[model samples]
Target: MKEEQKHIEALHDIKDMMNRSSRFISLSGLSGISAGLCALAATIYIWPVWLAVREKLRTGGDLQVYPYPATDVQRLLIMTGIVTFLTALLLALLFTWMRSRKTNTSMWGSTAKRLMTNTAIPLIAGGLVTYRLLDLELVGLIAPSCLIFYGLALLNGSKYTVSEIRWLGICEIILGIINLWFIGYGLVAWAIGFGVLHILYGALMWWKYERV
Candidate 1:
């Protein structure tokens, strides 16, 4: 019986090792937290610009937020979005890389490539669709589409990583769907979906996985 138990334990250890090598499990919850903070800060910074544009248009009796914004304002908004994305991307990569190092895992391996490929497909599709929407001036749909596609990407990639990500993705998709009816509050929805949800997910993950 003692020898049988030892053999079983050894087999279990080997199974765990194989599982670790095949999956990218070094993701840190701090990465999500940092990304959320960056998103929230960007949203806070952009809120005033959006409000100022709305107020300016209101004075001219054009209170609708969907109308194409002034050229400078439009450019500013686009720049802000790009900067926010880059910042979040940078923070995520930094934290993830740190975690990988701490775990003595390769950050750029076959598993990572698979994860990225699964994630990028929906995002790329969403980006192309959003660009066309912007061209057609259907800007209201942009936020919802982004949320939905991001949720889908997360869902697609979650199979390769932690299961918690799938729940986050579901929440995001639900929020995006609801936002469709509330187009007037697109920015608010975006903030909640990207900023608030990320923070919550990060906190939960940290508490569950990182805390003693």
Candidate 2:
């Protein structure tokens, strides 16, 4: 019996080593948590501005949500988004690096490169599409579009990381599709997709991986 158990353990270790070599498994849940918090903070700070933008789009004569903001308020809102994204990315990188150190994993590897490439394609396409939407003043679809694309990116990259991310991607896609009907509530949907979903996924991952 002991011999059998030893053989099983060896098999498990071999499997684990193979997984680590092929996948970037050192991603920290704290990264997601920090990102979610940053998104929520940005959402809160920009809520009023979003409200005004929605009102303007609904009533303003031009009815054009240009790539460039027409008002100081709108510009500030844009800045807020940029800042939030940068902050989240910075924190995420920091946390991931910390985890990689703890696990003695290489932060830059073929697996990580593949993950980034897969994730970037969707995000880059989404950015271009979003700009076109703004040019056309189809502001209502922007939030849903972002959610969908981000979810797709997550799905694309999830194969290289934790399995939990795929579920998060699915949830984001579902929420984005549902938000299509609630066009007036783009900000709310954005919060739910980016902020709330991140928090839930992060918490679950932390509980499962980090708590121990």
Candidate 3:
């Protein structure tokens, strides 16, 4: 009886260790779906405005009100930064809520902290660089570069998350390469890459992991 109890305790300890080392536990499929939906909505909301500005630029009309031409590139970058930060916050909240219901582990634990820092730092840096290049009117390649670097960040951090996420990262990189041929359609490309891709990925995750 004593030996049997020891074996049971040892088995429980091994299970606990395995749980701690696994990367996919804190990830919530519903959160992915929600984020994707939000991106799609945001893209739909922003598209008309983007089209109007582009039409004006094509017609050689004044762009004073658009803010992109007159505002320093850094200001535009700040806007991008704000958008990125808000998106991250929203996703973080979703992750936290899902993890709370799905597991005993805290979403804000060391693992999550490491994941965010690793994924975000490269993205932010690449975004700033892209903004600077855009400001210089050296813009034909900016969107693709941004996508590629963002995908790199995702791929690099995939070990701390689901394998599906790494596949998505690979897709993003491929899409970014294809986007190079559509330089004049940068806004549309951005919408498809960030907005559409997220929706698809999120839906898949939700269906596969969260539907139960």
Candidate 4:
């Protein structure tokens, strides 16, 4: 009996060790839901204000009242960069804290480090190129291009993470194609694709996976 008990304890130990070695533990559904909701709220708050500003520029009579088109594009890019960076940083810190609380392990693991590095490279390169293209007014199919590449990135990295994320990428690609039909609403499409879809995915993930 004692030998059997020892064997059971050893098995448990091995299981625990395996769990510790696994990646993707920081993917908490609750965290996803919270982040998504935050995105949605931010979109709701910002989009109208942005539209109002654009409308003012359109109607202000003074052609020079608005900055140069290039200046406006640069400003938009900078704002987007700041917002994206802050979102990433905030999520990272939140996940790190949560994971530390749950498992006495460092959140900055090889998997997360690799994931961030891999994801950032293509995105940064594509974003810079897209910005230049937009500045040059070569925006005939920029929205679709961005969507396709972003989806590809997500799909490529999905193997290291959750399967749902892969589906999200596919959906993004589809949405991007749809956006081509309404090129005038590119900003709205982007906001919906990223902000709305995130909330929906996060809520579903939380409901199905995280809820006990």
Best by TM-score: 2
lDDT of 1 by residue, 1-212 (tens): 99999999999999878868777777788888988888899899999988887566556553333567788989998998899999988998998898899888899988888889999999999899988877776767888888999999999989877779999999999999998887657789889988999999988888887775
Ranking by lDDT: 1, 2, 3, 4
User: Which has the higher TM-score value, candidate number 1 or candidate number 3?
Assistant: 1
What is the C-alpha local distance difference test score of each model?
A: 0.85, 0.84, 0.69, 0.63
The digit string of per-residue lDDT tens for model 2 on 121-178 reads 9999988997787667677778889899899999988988877899999998898899
* Candidate 1 vs candidate 2, TM-score winner: 2
lDDT score for residue 200 of model 1 = 92
Worst 10 contiguous positions by lDDT, candidate 4: 61-70
| Per-model TM values vs. the true structure | 0.90, 0.92, 0.75, 0.69
Clashes of each: 0, 0, 0, 0
After superposition, the stretches of candidate 4 with alpha carbons farther than 4 Å from their true spots are 1-22, 49-77, 103-105, 138-145
Question: What residue pairs are clashing in model 2?
Answer: none
Tell me the spans in candidate 3 whose CA falls farther than 4 Å from its real position. Answer: 1-19, 22-24, 59-81, 84-88
Worst 10 residues of 3 by lDDT: 61-70
Question: Candidate 4 vs. truth: CA RMSD?
Answer: 5.8
What residue pairs are clashing in model 3?
Answer: none
For residues 1-212, what per-residue lDDT tens digits would candidate 3 score against the true structure?
99999999999999867756666456766565566666566657656755665675657643332224435533554465467548855885777566656777777777677778888887888888877776766555676878888888888778776668898788888888888776657666766777678778877877876666
